[model samples]
Target: MLELRKINKSFGSRKIITDLDLQIEQGSILCIVGPSGGGKTTILRMLAGLESIDSGEVLLSGQPFDPTNLKEQEQVVGVVFQDFQLFPHLNVFENITLAPKLSLKQDKAVYTKNAEELAQRLGLANLLNHYPYQLSGGQKQRVAIARAMAMNPKVLAYDEPTSALDPGLSQQVADLILEMKQAGMTQIVVTHDLDFAKRIADQLYQVTPVE
Candidate 1:
């Protein structure tokens, strides 16, 4: 469903990705395991159009990646960063519903029903009105997942998804991920957690060490 052909990106004199090439299948989970600063997040940013590719291309299905037209990419991908970028002031209901409500611009009642359904699936039904500060680390991360699901994305990219959580909570997140896997969500996760990766990924690509 996605292809990265000789995709290269750099910051001035330092190159992070050099002739990196990959093809990801639909409905498969992939793990990208490597050292810090090994161009993992750079790959995600490039795919998400948060950062530009220096050379080569990232194609969704068969078309080239376009930075300007996000609406064109809406149904194709989603992502979860390590920091769990939830809005601090917004309640969980607001944070989770923000993207879909803004992008889809559906009626409040319809969006609310959709948001509530996702929240319930992710075990956040009772916490919708709670703010970020009111949630535990796991709660925040689940809210992040629910937010992504709210967008109805088919391809999900998870960057070190469980890195900041404690052992118990990390496993909780992994369990949630596994549920998604069983439901046929295509995911690419960049993580150092081998056991967790093995539990979820259908394939593994160890990012090569940079010289």
Candidate 2:
């Protein structure tokens, strides 16, 4: 399980999250919803080790997790940023396999095989050669998701998952999230879309900005 205990965060004089706690079990989906700038993305970043916590503890299973430890953190948490953060310089396949290729140091054929399977599952098999700019918003999101899944981490986090897509495409993303959870992947999502949160989340957290 992933748990945050009495977490506090501040940027300069402005506080974001204070005395906040969350828990997500393996194979469950946790969606966090709130108003804009309510620190939802900050929470996701802190969970992914992209941001530091001011105080409190982040634990994986029952052990403490150190945000300063990149190598250990990457082994457990994978994040899909709100903007879909795909590499502009690399094609889809390259983007998806980049981390695994570097970390696993396996033969090209091995990671390529795994990437192909993941792309097929995420409906991106046909777009392997396409660049991010060449694809639509929804396609880029799927590519981002595939890239994250390729890491095979214990936890997956998405920030504002449906913000950039049309309503139709947003539903597709919701379905994809549910499919991933049903396949036994733990997920943590931050979004303002309550309906989308209802569709996929096993647990939902409401966050209010600390005044």
Best by lDDT: 2
User: What is candidate 2's CA lDDT for residue 5?
Assistant: 97
Candidate lDDT values, in order: 0.83, 0.88
Give TM-scores for every candidate, taking all chains together and pairing residue i with residue i: 0.92, 0.95
Clashes of each: 0, 0
User: Mind giving the per-residue lDDT tens digits that candidate 2 earns over 1-211?
Assistant: 9999999999999999989988899899999999987999998888877789999998988999776576732667788888998989999999999988888675799889999999899888899999999999999998998888887788989999888888788888888888988899999999998988998889999987666
Clashing pairs in 2: none
Which lDDT value does model 2 have at 139?
92
**Model 2 lDDT-worst window of ten:** 67-76
lDDT (0-100) at residue 64 of candidate 2?
A: 95
lDDT of 1 by residue, 146-200 (tens): 8888888868888898887888777787788888888888888988778888887
- After superposition, the stretches of candidate 1 with alpha carbons farther than 4 Å from their true spots are 72-75
Q: Which clashing pairs does model 1 show?
A: none
lDDT of 2 at 122: 86
